[model samples]
Target: MTETLRASAPPVATGAGAIAVLRDLASYVDARAEAFSARSSWLVAAATHLAGEPVVVVAHEDGQVVGLAALSVTRHRGTARVTLLGGELNDYGQLHHDGPRAARALAGALVDWLRAQRRWSLDLTQLAPEDPALAALVRLLPGAVVSPGAPMPRIEGVGTSYRVKRDRRRKATGAFNAAGRDGLRAEKLVLDDLAGLERWLPALVEVRRARDHASGRRSQLDDPGVLAFHTSVVRGAVAAGAGVVHVMLVEDEVAGFVTVLVDGDTHRLYDGRVAERWLAYRGGTVCDIEAVLRAQDDPGVHTFDWLRGWTEAKFGNAEVVRAGLHASSHPSVDRLDRWEATARRRLKAALPDAAVRRIVSR
Candidate 1:
């Protein structure tokens, strides 16, 4: 039986009710949904704290949210551009939808919405190559430019074996003995409530700052807006019982940490950082191994996603999946946007890291 579909009005802002529904739909539709990014909580949080205007399009069936797309309108190089909300931090780009039919309807609605917002060209990043949303977009927008994005590594059946656990202990003891550090411990904080998130978030941010400074790089979390968005999204996910924070300490100080989000059966490491000084002690390895143990114990989770990176040596043994990038615009502006993007990439590559950071912050 065919379902009746009706797209909501050009969305200026989504109400709480609709947003909640969209949040659930994301997990329902995407098997490997990065809860921190795919959920509507991310969209709402980004809209609240990040710059630029928010644009959301919704498709409903029987008065329930069946599909949706959340976007932001901003000026890029003096031209209005539309991009996926939370694109900078999000691991994947997907149209939140119920199924194949809803995907097609949502794609059609996106086309109409894009036409109405004629001044803005679309640029979506990190789309999974096999995503129905990507397929729908390509089918409808044949002229859209498509490119390959980074590969996302994932580990299935992530439970640690007896040998792995023994190796971990051996490494920890050896490192502790060599460093002469007696106060070494790891704590995996299962932040299922807002109060816990509030308590630990500041320390996590500071750890990230210290790590960046040690590595001679700047942390994006240093930006007040980005920090606020992350706070909101994590809090929202934790409150929904879908996320947690794992922190490892040395001498009772934060040494390394990672945020994990469980979307259905998949566990994802959203972000993590380790202090440079602690690298000698395998701080990051300890934290990640513990995450794998946690996932193994949880009957609800079966896979652990390492997210976007080709660090084979670091990950040991994990499978790789393809991610994608794409852009679409009116023929008049397509060439212009593409050219401007190429120029910006080239200039960014040529400039010093500090110079590029300054330009991006502005």
Candidate 2:
């Protein structure tokens, strides 16, 4: 964890070298983040995908990817938004480090890289409270609000309630029964028993897209790689003996769904979506609740994170709220506000009332 301060941050200047970092990342990430991030390929792939983009920067450690930062640039709505591409499901940094100081060094390197690139700002998704890298970033960049655009969703554990929490015996079981009586079913998939995800991906994508269209929003399913990555997540989760994709079928229909990220000690829910048609049943909550019940089966799991944004249900139900930290050197809390104003002005001038969406390249 000791500091080995480098004179400069790493970037992909030469095509051959950038390709090397991508490959090294793909390999080392396969090992370092192997167990931590369930979908190791996607996190590692972030560097590979961003390598081809016009603007992308990565921090290298001895020709290996000890750390990386991806920026997804778009000039939508006449304003620019740079998505600080990390994990879409959670706003957490998965740096390859031996200790906290190693993580900090990487953070400093990434912030410096971004600033050098002249990016207006960045948006990190699904921010986690325990990320020490982000903590160090806040130390360097005092002006960044960790929670700017994206809001973390609400989350709760089955055992964190009163009626079932009075005693430890049967906590999850009690909650599951209550949910079932309320017309919700909670269960995990037997990896071998279900259809191959190669087959499931397309159908799942359709369901997700339709759900999004019905909600008047764009489905993440629109992107082929994003869809592929999600598909990989399902496959990886099952292969690791980690957890299953819990589905909340309403009246024998895929009413809501959530992919639970699992390890021995942590269980996280991602891609949680509920159809607008199921509002009466709180379909989203139903799926979320069911996922938690299934997670309880893993006695080793102690923390259930909503993973990024704050939500009404998650805050109300969770006994412990993991507050995410945002550290940046921007030095002005009003920077985001100022950028937003510029974006608004640019949008009006450029498109003249047309909805401008900056196409984010991988």
Best-performing candidate as measured by lDDT? 1
Which lDDT values do the candidates have, in the order given?
0.67, 0.51
Residue-level error in angstroms, candidate 1, position 238: 3.2
lDDT of candidate 2 at residue 62, scale 0 to 100 = 67
Query: Per-residue lDDT tens digits of candidate 1, residues 277-316?
Result: 6777655666676676688777667778888877632353
- Per-model TM-score, in order, reads 0.78, 0.61
Give the root-mean-square deviation of each candidate in angstroms: 4.7, 7.5
Query: 1-362, model 2: which lDDT tens digit per residue?
Result: 11222213345433344434434445444455524342345553443443223233555556544555444455443333455433454344444443576667677776776565443445554334566766777777656566533543433443443112333224434543454677665443322223544444454566677776655446676766666655666676666666566554445455556666664566766566665544454555656665665555556666565665566545324433233334333434246656978997785577522232222111
Q: How does model 2 fare in lDDT? A: 0.51
Q: What is the lDDT of candidate 1?
A: 0.67
lDDT score at residue 314, model 2, on the 0-100 scale: 59
What is the number of backbone collisions in each predicted candidate, taken in the order shown?
Answer: 0, 20
Clashes of 2: 20
